[model samples]
Target: MARPLLSAHAERRTSVDYPYSETMYASVHHERRAAFGAELYGALGIGSGDHTARAVYDAESLRFYGAPHAAFLFVQGDGEARLAADVGAYMQTLLLAMTAYGVDSCPQGLLSFYADTVRAELGVTGGRLLVGISFGYADASSPVNQVKTERAPLESTTAFHDQGPSSESVRP
Candidate 1:
């Protein structure tokens, strides 16, 4: 598993750092994230006001949702936006391949918050932790697995130029 990740990372010829801006999600993105969170917790019988329940649920990421295997993705260089984009692309490909192999995977940004601890534990040096992926056979009967968040329609998220005003555009 590590070999494939390393190979892919090298092939991409890019090194990354953290994957988010200082503001993280803002405006509409923040709203969407909040809605998704509500949907997720609701599926688990947790109310929006249930702070205790939310904390416990969030802690599941630290345990990788009881996954048997995990992968930490890192890049060897200072933070660069281009390299971060490349890493993101690599992550998508890796996740797709895992799905094709019947492996269930979850990409956890929470892990990056403990980047220093992870590096210390792994005895790694000089790489910025980008993300961590937890993977294993999924429990088909789990209620959490049943949670599905709605996606914003393409017309509301994408802009088309040089086509015509009739074409879908996110602009006002």
Candidate 2:
């Protein structure tokens, strides 16, 4: 069965109105979102108006990416700015460590929607469910694994002072 993502209860349970999210979507975050969306849909060969094909592709992709393991990122604090900042820092550190160990990872906010299910499965009593990461050794043969998204230049997203040498835009 093809499951739709926006059931009525799902909207109530998962949708959150973050204050800065509006500003993000409206301005500073717009370019990267557009670029990423373009790359993603291009990779899937789905045109803008091809909603049916897009839906089928999304459903199939969910099942296709059945990675062996997923790790949830959680915090013992409420959804406060400081706590979310800490979570971001921790996730970055963890992802760096995983890369050093040759493990592939995909951080997922989608998993957090089913927070109740996660808490039940993991016997978690406290802490807010923040996000999850799916990881495994890379399967280089897979086209999905080969897909890459465009990132904004470092200078566009970062600010520098009279600190060190000339800041060069990092490219991957």
Candidate 3:
């Protein structure tokens, strides 16, 4: 038997006037995804060319909110990407506080996919739901909770220059 989704955005068919805060996403460059594909997939234990394992992990990560309580962050439809930065900072603060209090949290961009669900339940309107954060005392026994991801070296992502040195003295 086929099951039904409780909150499918396709059924509502609402036009999203607000753009996703990601500039590359709005620009529609598929290659942008490919650029980070290796790092992201590698951290998830997805082997090179292992499409099946990748797909499974993707679905699993997107589904499981991983926490009991969720807080949605929304901004006015007219808000620009700068507003997203402020919201991100605020969210980080919340995460830090949660960590200090022995609470675990998961920040999921996947939550934004079901914006309609949030709107209807929370009476939210005139704003774009940018992200959702789920927080609760963690279940340490869950294998999913133990999954870890590695971060790329800062030098790989940053560029530095020596102002008082030769023109060729640049670092990456």
Candidate 4:
């Protein structure tokens, strides 16, 4: 099953245009994506200017990073933001559970780009693809597996409103 899916994905290599509006991917998100790519490719000795090498490395996602099992998540709807959010939460919980059980998993939004190919291959109908997770034991010896991207600080991503309205604020 994985082989057929991989072959179909590779055959139809052209990913559809992003399913959501560009505004959703803000500058901060772009920065993080760039950082993650740099870390990953750098770990494999692929230079930033090497587009061919980058593409080859990225193609591994379709191969599920050689994981034995893959799961594609889909929500029944027309790509509503709320539905996507709910699926995202479900994915997080699923990933955490896999971790607790010592099963490695990588959630790939890249898979959603080829939703049509996936749907056709899996005989799925009437759902918006949200994400695909590849799960199995990770190859610890692989350099690609060694890359660790840093996370933004809590303060940078969160705001507190513990206190009531500020003294300078006008109340209704």
Clashes of each: 0, 0, 0, 0
Q: Write the per-residue lDDT of candidate 2 for residues 1-172, one digit (tens) a residue.
A: 0123234223455432222244646565676677776677777677878988867565442232566777877777565778878988999999999999998888866666656666666788877777778778878886666678766789977897775554685656
Model 3 residue 115 CA deviation in Å? 1.5
Give the TM-score ranking, best first.
Answer: 4, 1, 2, 3
**In candidate 3, what are the lDDT values of residues 1-172, reduced to their tens digit?**
0011133432644334245456536332445456456666765577779998976665443344445577888876455778877888898999999999998888877667666666776887767788877778777775555655444577965798756867687788
Model 4 regions more than 4 Å off: 1-23, 163-172
Best by lDDT: 4
lDDT of 1 by residue, 112-148 (tens): 7666666766788877888999999989889889977
In model 4, residue pairs whose N, Cα or C atoms come closer than 3 Å (at least 3 residues apart or on different chains), thus clashing, are none
Measured by TM-score, the strongest candidate is 4
Give the whole-model CA lDDT for all candidates, comma-separated: 0.77, 0.66, 0.64, 0.83
TM-score of each: 0.78, 0.73, 0.62, 0.83
Question: Over the stretch 27-72, how does candidate 4's per-residue lDDT look in tens digits?
Answer: 9999898899888888999999999988887878888889999899
Give the distance in Å from residue 137's predicted Cα in candidate 2 to where it truly belongs.
Answer: 1.9
